[model samples]
Target: MRQSEAIACLREKGYKQATLVLLFAAIDQLAWVAGDKETVGNEGFKAWVQQYMVEKNPELLSGATAADLWGARCGVLHTGVAESNDFRKGYARRILYASNYGQVGSNDPTVLTLSLEWLGSAFAAAIVWFLSDLEADPEKDTRAREKLSRMLVDQQP
Candidate 1:
């Protein structure tokens, strides 16, 4: 699916904890696929996590950041509790809808479908983080952009 559509779905959902879980799962899957990893297991995920670090210009793993987000997602999914009363609904529906019907590669529909889901989730999470930055008083939005740029640079072997 187009990135815009994915973001729209996430926006429509508003912001919910469960959606956050799905979003992270999707991102984990994307990192696996992007890194050409075959499995999504713990070991595999560790390697997948490394992809994020390797992509960083300074080569530091944002383990603390990832762990905090992960812990929050787990709490939400397990407790059925939202830290905020304002639980954003319809996010999964939007993700599912866009993922199911997204227009993508002509080569392999199955792979494309998976990729679409992953990309949609990952991109959606990114948008949420970006928006949070505005609220968090982020001085800059260079981290993600810089890491991505470095990934591209390193990949050009």
Candidate 2:
């Protein structure tokens, strides 16, 4: 449901920031569920993105590291900025978005340009990949299920 909403926002003309927020939030939530933890700190978020998102969609996220995405996530969620402390401190590159995937370029070496559409698609693919992984691994599936059961959901009347 969250993935769908993110994609919907992505397809809209002027919802780039909202799309990013939802996409990043989905990553955080999935990371927590995948780890079977009630909470996931920065390290955990980075690790999960590295394993599940970056590694899974390298071409779409070329030149972007888990740390870069993590920094973006923090910046966007915390202050509605694109550059985080990590980017300012030389820890991660600042990210800019384009219209589609494979359209990456930036004059500044410390900055990266990616396609927001590609990002949304890649993230959706990552979720599918993660689900397949859980299906193949019973232990992981059980753990994720346990965590998911604890997640709050709107009750249908």
Candidate 3:
């Protein structure tokens, strides 16, 4: 819930890269929750994002594969850059971000550009959609609830 609050605040403040880092991390965390797994490896992250984020926000995440997003997430979160081993190894595309109501585009075929605001909004919408889908699937909902119940809480003395 704190992550959700932080993301909401970052999105409101228009911190492009910071917002993206949290967003990607949120997806990773949710993937584990949804699957009732203790941990989500790289493949799990890709699969979850592919099934949830990419499918729900195809228009916003167009031209960027789940692998590409994973690479971007690693780069942004680990190195504070936009290039990762996945990109360097030709397994994923490099991604650049734009802010201030910019459009998503790319000058090179291997490098995709996306709008920060749009990506944030798309991710938010995708969460809503994912939760709705989870509601219809009793098994997944039960798994999600179990995982969510174990999440860390911010307790005050």
Each candidate: RMSD to true structure?
16.4, 2.0, 2.1
Candidate 1 local lDDT, 1-157, one digit each (tens): 2334444566457543334555555555544444433445444444433334223311121112333233333444455442312123211111111234334333422111123344344445444544454346433334334333543222222
Q: After superposition, how far is residue 133 of candidate 3 from its true place, in Å?
A: 1.9
Global CA lDDT computed for model 1: 0.37
lDDT of 3 by residue, 1-157 (tens): 6777788798788676788888888988888887756879788788888887788787777567889999999999999898999999998898898874656677788898887776776777778877997999999999898888888767744
The reply for model 3, stretches above 4 Å from the true place, is 155-157
Residue pair clashes in candidate 2: none
Alpha-carbon deviation at 127 in model 2, angstroms: 0.6
Tell me how far candidate 1 lies from the true structure as C-alpha RMSD in angstroms: 16.4
- In the range 1-157, model 2's lDDT, one tens digit per residue, is 6456645766686778888887888789889988856779888888888887788888888668999998899888888888898888988888888876466788888888888877877787888888999999999999999888888765544
Backbone clash total, candidate 2: 0
- Against the true structure, what is each candidate's TM-score? 0.34, 0.89, 0.89
lDDT of each: 0.37, 0.82, 0.82
Report the number of backbone clashes for model 1: 2
Q: Which stretches in model 2 have alpha-carbon errors above 4 Å? A: 155-157
